[model samples]
Target: MDHAETITLADGARIATWTRAGPAEAPHVVLLHGGPGLWDYLEPLAGLIGDEATTHRYDQRGCGASSPSDEQSVARSVADLDELRAHWELDRFVPIGHSFGATLALAYAAAYPERVPAVGYVSGVGIGDWRTPFRNERRRRAEPFAARLAELSVPQRTADEEVKWRTLTWATDYADLTIGLRAASAMAHSPHVINQHANRAVSFTDADQIGWAAAVRCPVYVVHGTADPRPAANALQLADRLARPRKRVVTEAGHLPWIEQPEQLRELLAEIVQAGRC
Candidate 1:
């Protein structure tokens, strides 16, 4: 990472932002991480493309090193991104998002089409209806693990217990249990400060909740893992919705492509940035 800083929004919320230096005239690429509340895990991935473009990553408000805030809705998230863009003096750039971040990126593009040249969505949670299918898939894959946890008498009542359950459940997210365990171990040290209030505030009843895919005026690159519990069909459907979309499915990967398929992720991001420059 080139440098890190905290930008205080107009509302007094501070956002932790990082920028990896690249070519001075290169197109700016902002990375949006998943977990409506997770910080920037894409830093390593950012380094992979630092030579090609000016890459940026940040902890959304109330996530990572950023100060906590009661205002954590999707609209607030988009506004914060807009503020970051102005703070960096960027007129337009490419936004690449993962999971929930991908959803937010789409929302941002819909709200400010003129500000985004193109978008890259990886393992993205598409359309509101994705929840049911995702849940069923996750449950099906996690059954054995869930049973084992039950035998161990793991309680799911408290916040800590919920975290433990979620951590263990993450095994279903990867094709390899060892990788899942490693990810869970890393997450154990980090603060899982999710903004439940903000999560409840945003409703995704319709595809138009944010900006419909038809409204996006830029090219969209959609990447998903075949082994990801979240249905691949959602990605294909999302690609169909976008005005201009390119879809790629990695066979051996799961939900966390950066961890399972970093090179492919890096190439896809470079492609998006290069396309934006054209």
Candidate 2:
């Protein structure tokens, strides 16, 4: 693994990061991890991108080792990505966004389809006309999570304090279900910063997000799961919207299929990148 070095933004935020196996000359790849404040924790698929892709993984504004959010909001997170791409002068990029990262990637592709090559959208949001379906599926899948969350009370007097408490202790509070995000958040971003970022991310909503995804001309590969509780029907709905040439729905994995089905992910990715424009 080649440690992710930094290219300071004009705003002067020191972002922590690293890159995985690929030559400097190879085509650039930007791997997007979900979990708004989850940090840069996706390492399983980095090696799978092969030699042709120079995979870049970095902490979001307030996650991982990256600089804390400049403004602590979803708009800022999206802006950070845009700013980073501009700063790097990257002509074309392959966005491999997983889970929540998938939603962000779709938003980016929809907003700036010209900057992207193709998208490896894995178990992402249902940004098509499947909001009700996706929402129901999320409710179904998130039930267990929500149940667990319900059991572990936010240990605060008021809703504001609860949010603050969780914001500071998200990694700890949701440690088990989230795979130790508390320590990662603590090590990478502070509670205040993570909470602010979460506030922005949770508040993120755009009716045009789905409209943009529908209008995007770029090819998309959707790797969804059969057993994974989250977004089950939404995946099919999204693929249906894109149709065959630009879509693929994996039947065996769950929310994070890159980790669950790496080979399938690699094959689909290779197919998409090799197929070029639809």
Candidate 3:
């Protein structure tokens, strides 16, 4: 059983929380979680790599144990990814992202496919326009969503009260967590990291991400729930425009497919990772 660990970014900010449960020298796989603030998501994912590989999960700054600062940017997060790879002395490794994390992974691979071994995006989102397909569903769903938000304990909530009480849940838990949102919130409490991750993500865009997405030169597989309300469709739209070896769509699941359907998701991911590793 490997243990958890932490690392500091160049800014001297302690921006990571991770778990290592497989062979230390095996293929290194990094899990990029959603929630600009959330980062702690290794527990459930630890099992996937088993003895075959090494897996690490971490929180973005301002979430979990990471110090909060005003230097947040999709570009900075991308820099953080680059920094982590260099810090780990990794010449190449697989990068996987869930929802917002998925988008980041895509952006990362797009920018540095040479360094990224392979990529998998679960319930991925893009940084673009806001869609409230459920705006009225908010009438029917807002109360339940808000109620769920209020139900979270402090560590699970972000630093902001209303977001802790509102936005985080809508973005991550709109479906089911036991496997999804909770996995995402492994970073900061939701109001702080998770909600902030979402707030920053939906609208996050870097000229690099767009250029990178267009130039992604490797295998990219995206898994999303057919039943997933918003991000699911968005995942498909991005997939359509992507180059060959790009897979998009995971049906019969919702936004939290990694947890809602971990085994299947893991199997699908395994195939893509293997292909990329080849």
Candidate 4:
């Protein structure tokens, strides 16, 4: 947390951002947390690789301390990232994206390949139809918490209910069920609201995915956890589409590999960031 500030975009959307300093000569890396609606939750990840590269993270628009707005679109999100890059005076940087952020990072790289040296894709929902399988797997895994989770899914919920709901909903995302509830609860932080609009705006069709994959010229490192409800096969397909791609599947880890396998994820990210300097 070396630096934290609010960056006001030209379109009047203010994004809350944080920067952690690393070695002065190290390349810059931007960590894009999952969830179009959820606030930033990559601080631990930033700290893990702080010795190797300067790390940047932000709460997407309408999330956390960022100004709330419904004007969400993939183009707007890319523009905001570019503005942040200009503000930081970075010529180029590696983008490490998780879940939905992985897709967003790809979109950004496709739009401005020159500004992006590489991309780190973690737990991304890849091209084609992946949601059906993910939902089926999650449903089976979440059976124990199903009743309570359903009760908490109403449009309006108390803060405690929000936390509980999120915890139950995300409990299936971990390889170890014993620690899953606790981890998910801890992640259900402030601004409990989920920007459904933002989530809808950033989705990629099969065509969009293939086009972006073909458009991006930089190297892409795709990593997925074996135990993650989201199938790693999708990530494999995405990696295959890239011109320069590196793929890894971590055994026994969950959707958020940094939490389950920090050392491995750190090493991989360090490699990607170092490549950005080339």
Candidate 5:
């Protein structure tokens, strides 16, 4: 929360960036929030790190405060990160990515293994067949709101209705309905639009992800939540592919561990930063 600025990419896309001050010699940690289209929402998670490590977070091109673009792909996103690291003058850093962002982080590491000391993959849906099970579990959990959710999911919806629809849909990501509803409501921030094209274009299948993992030369922390409907087994699949993967599972946590288990996630990230320093 200390600094904010906008950086222009080679493609002329403007990306909004933020920074939190930490020790000059501390490990640099770049946080990648999930969603191919959603804006940055890792402020709380970033706050947990405090001054332990210098942190940089930004809206992916065409998301949040970033400029929209007709071109979106995994390669472009990885290139963007490398550009940002150069702009930030970071020699090396750890990329902690959540959800889809986790996949992006892995791709970055694979593309530039020399610049990445480690990677944090949190709540990621690995390149496995987790989508089917996730959908089934989400369907079971969302039975109470199914009718309304379907109604609001139509092509045209008022802004308010869109938020409602998103809340109901995302609420299924939590194990506790009460906390899930509250957290999902907060995540339903304004200007929220899911870029279906970006989601599809920037994603990787398990087969391709495995190929990418082969190129990664650093250690990867594959962190997952036990109660996260996405199936922790998917995380294991990703871990198995990494050259050096450390898997951690948070008990009773849904998708976003920072919300339900801030201290635990904080400890894990702190450990990662410290390890990167060594």
Candidate 6:
């Protein structure tokens, strides 16, 4: 991927966006990263599908290199996505969202179904409440690494400390801790870069209330790792609610399937692109 370009939104917030040049007429895909406040970590997955589509990935407003704002909300994030699409001059595109990004993507599609040809929800936070299940799953998986994780999570942390904290916590998101650590290492290092206000605001909002799946007019492809903490049952339920949906459950993967099952993910992405073209 090339260096990011700055796009100033209507509200004057500048978002950092990166695009991988591909065939002019290829399908366009915009990747939404998770963590209402987390930086972009989807570059590896973008690289895997670069030849198939004109890929675009960005640090959403108030995250990574994007300008921070106190007005951050799910509504604002969805608007930012629309702004991005307009900036790219794309009449329609496919959105591939991971974790919380999936929630945002669904919201975007709900608000403007005509702009989205299809969606790829990878390890998505599906409909209904996921907090209780996620907490329980995290505790169950973090038991083995509790001591080390506890030591890493302090009140105030330096950049390296934040990286260690994120790495330790995210390590459980994979079937293998080693792979998880390696994957998490690519995450943004500075805690200062994350907007806690935005994270808290979006977290408290209910994505299901938006009625995005029901409003969706295009095919939705949902992928979940069987071992992911959010639960595969949620994905199944979400697929059932959509107008048209397809799903794949990767047995050995966890939250970040792109890290654990890149080849399989690439194939799934290719399928989504083809489906969109159809």
In order, candidate lDDTs are: 0.79, 0.61, 0.64, 0.85, 0.87, 0.82
Candidate 2, residue 200: Cα displacement in angstroms equals: 4.8
Error of 4 at 57 (Å): 0.8
Model 2 spans > 4 angstroms off = 21-25, 70-74, 127-151, 156-202, 240-245, 275-278
Q: Which of 1 and 5 is ahead in lDDT?
A: 5
Candidate 5: segments with Cα more than 4 A from true spot: none
Give the worst 10-residue stretch by lDDT in candidate 1: 202-211
Index of the highest-TM-score prediction: 5
RMSD of each: 2.5, 5.9, 4.7, 1.3, 1.1, 1.9
- Please give, for residues 48-116, the per-residue lDDT of candidate 5 as tens digits: 888889999999988878888768888889999999999999889999999988998999998888899
Candidate 3, superposed: residue stretches over 4 Å from native: 127-130, 134-198, 201-203, 206-209
TM-score of 5: 0.97
Using all chains and alpha carbons, the TM-scores for the candidates as numbered come to 0.90, 0.72, 0.77, 0.96, 0.97, 0.93
lDDT of 2 at 172: 31
TM-score-sorted candidate list, best first: 5, 4, 6, 1, 3, 2
Model 1 regions more than 4 Å off: 148-163
lDDT per residue for candidate 4 within 1-278, as digits (tens), equals 56998898887888889998888898998888778877788888887886788999999888777889887777777888899999989999898889988988998999999989889888998876688999999999888878888899899988888888888888789998777878887887555577777777665587887889999999898889999999998888878899998888777899988888888887887788877888
Give residue 181's lDDT in candidate 4 (0 to 100): 79
Better of 2 and 3 by lDDT: 3
Worst 10 residues of 5 by lDDT: 189-198
**Candidate 3, overall lDDT?**
0.64
- Worst lDDT 10-window in candidate 6: 203-212
